[model samples]
Target: MNARKTWTRTLGTATAAGALAWAVVAAGQPSAAPTSEPVAETGPGYAIEDYNYPGADRILAEQGIVLKRGDGHIVLADCLSEENLLRFLARGRADVCFKVTADEGFLTLEIPSVHGVRTDDSVNTHLAMTAEDDRVEYDIPAKTWEGVGESVDGREHVLVEIRVTK
Candidate 1:
């Protein structure tokens, strides 16, 4: 008699649990709602990273600097904005400066007739430029101004890339 009662209780509990699970699953299923409009399929698009410089067209128009792309650690800045800036000199134009926020940085740009680069106090800088069909590179020490590009060879060189390490 005790065994029969135990079996009966177990069967009842199992049936209740099964019914509860079925109710939960059925509740999750889609049902007809009182809507007259069709569902739209549109949504916000995905985000993508292209690495192109922001406001590049505006800066090119305003400053004549052809900024291409970078890792965002190095950026164009006002020459007089702060000290310890990476300064660049180009012929037929004013000196350009950049601010470095990290221990390492990279920027690719085009500045025609670049002849000199001044490194900040914290980073050793490497510069790459091109003149006609030849490529030129310079390694500049921290807190030093080094003549690069056309200053060394008299050929007009376009500054292409700047890499710095602390």
Candidate 2:
């Protein structure tokens, strides 16, 4: 009689545990409902790097400088804000300056009638300019002021780009 009772208890416990496991698995699974609509995107999809210059419109409006794009290393600076700044001299415009922060930097801009550039003490500079469809470039040494665009050829030129290396 004891052996029979033990067998019955064991069978009941086994059945109960199996049922509980089945219940848990069933609770985890979805109901047999068919979906008709496809899932749509929810959050912000992606961020792309456009490399456009920030505050370009405001800068152009305020300072008459057309800043297009850059690698974010060099930036416009106040001429009297600090020492060792890259200075630019242009016809019919105030002197412009830039501050270089990295080992290498590049900026594409349009400062019309740029005729001279004064480099800082840190890096060499290469400038590109255009005059009436003719493009010209100048390589300037550090800690020196050199005649550029219009000063070199007596024709009006627009400073287009600046590339610097330390």
Candidate 3:
């Protein structure tokens, strides 16, 4: 079957359970309609990457990558080699560049070619849309709702659409 429909069906099929499982950080924004214009690529000082990855101190400490994921907390896969681990922890990137983070009241994940920024509360929630495998040839050309996320086990990732906005 087509990937889009498949993904949609998979997500749409789930109701409360999926929302809790995905745990998007929409921060209870209610997935409102987009009011802002497409995020400009060459904005003033820096770029989208900067805004996307502000820091990893809090999240890193929280996950405790050095240790193992026992329960309740998330776990990153051992896909990283010894060399890659050092690079990722220090600089936070690999040729694959998968990231996990949480903000004031949100949790997020970024994958190799995409990004997922959602907010959540202690209740049920899901993303407004899915753009993970949608074949957009641009850098998120405008900000249609999408995301890149990691799995609970952190063994795999969902590199939702990103870096395609104009």
Candidate 4:
């Protein structure tokens, strides 16, 4: 063959081989496009929030108590964790106490069959309890023990919520 024709054929073959190699590499790789349509939430308008307390569900299921929500200010206390913690007395269950972390605190919980709550003078506190027919709120005097639930009305009451302020 002529030198110019031979050079031209060689260059064309190299170009064709390069294109074939590139197509093989591209076909083997995964596509970058999204696979499915975006999901639309259907049920409740409110987005489900993960307001889960770390161990609260297990505690509730095992102990038959519901400690649902808190603002990180008031938390369940180990009665022996600190001195002067607020204490609660229940009719059938052992006493439970709460430790106040901030100057003001709030916690929503359900402890059934509660009878009394004792507070420390450090923070002013309030309690809300519910009976079969009615809900009662109490302004607990600071540093004093207060009667609630069956102690006050002779009816079984469930302590529902608590709030405290310095």
Please tell me which model should have the higher lDDT, number 1 or number 3: 1
Clashing pairs in 1: none
Task: Give the alpha carbon lDDT tens digit for every residue of 53-134 in model 4.
Answer: 5579887887777888877777777888877888999988888888888888778899988998889668988898999979
Which ten-residue region of model 2 has the weakest summed lDDT?
35-44
Displacement of residue 165 (Cα, Å) in model 1 is 1.1
Look at candidate 4 and tell me the lDDT of residue 91. 85
lDDT of 1 by residue, 1-166 (tens): 9999999999999999999999999999999897664344455566677879999999999999999999898899999999889999999999999999999989999999998888999999999899999988888989998888888999999999999998
What is candidate 2's lDDT per residue for 52-161, written digit by digit as tens?
A: 78999999999999999898888999999998889999988889999998879999999999988999899999999999989998899899989998888999999999
Q: Candidate 4, which ten residues in sequence have the lowest lDDT sum? A: 37-46
**Residue-wise lDDT of candidate 3 within 45-98, one digit each (tens)?**
443332232335554565432221222122243434322110121114533322
lDDT of 4: 0.85
| Highest TM-score model number | 2
Pairs of colliding residues, candidate 4: none
Q: Return the lDDT, model 3, position 115.
A: 36
Ranking by TM-score: 2, 1, 4, 3
Q: Ranking under lDDT, best-scoring first?
A: 1, 2, 4, 3
Q: What is the C-alpha RMSD of each candidate to the true structure, in Å?
A: 10.8, 6.9, 32.7, 6.0
Quote the positional error of residue 123 for candidate 3 in Å.
30
TM per candidate comes to: 0.73, 0.75, 0.17, 0.69
lDDT of model number 3: 0.32
